[model samples]
Target: MQPGIHPAYRPVVFRDKVGGLAFLTRSTATSDRTVEWEDGNTYPVIDVEISSASHPFYTGQSRVLDTAGRVEQFRRRYGDRH
Candidate 1:
């Protein structure tokens, strides 16, 4: 490892607003915003649009695509070759 070349790694907070979830972890990412954590310490907060808490795949809320409908639509648009 080189000195004075690597970004500082420190504890930071990742917030998922949609899921109302926040977690503290080490990261090189920085932010001007800050928040008080459960441990009574302040850390930089990063707002994220999606995380495992709210993600469809992780939450098992994924939407099932209507393949049959799509196939029928395609056939209607262009007569079936068969």
Candidate 2:
């Protein structure tokens, strides 16, 4: 790797809005906001809408779509005249 050619890889805090969870990880992304972590250190904070904590697949809270009902409704509205 060329020196001074790569972005900085530093620790950042990703905060999940829905679950109110924060985690520290290294990323190339940067944020203006800072947060105090559990280790008594301040790091840049990035707010995310969804993460594994509140994700349906990870949390096993899948939502079933009513496709059959929607199809029946569509057929009733524009079905062949019989």
Best by lDDT: 1
lDDT of 1 by residue, 1-82 (tens): 8999999999999999899999999999999999999999999999999999999999999999999999999999998897
> How many times do residue backbones clash in model 2?
0
Cα lDDT for residue 82, candidate 2: 62
Query: Per-residue CA lDDT of candidate 2, range 33-75, in tens?
Result: 9999999999999999999998998899998999999999988
lDDT for every model? Answer: 0.97, 0.94
> How far out, in Å, is residue 7 in model 2?
0.8
In model 1, which regions exceed 4 Å deviation? 68-82
TM-score for candidate 1: 0.80
TM values, all candidates: 0.80, 0.76
Give candidates' CA RMSD values in order.
2.2, 3.3
Which consecutive 10 residues in model 1 have the weakest lDDT in total? Answer: 73-82
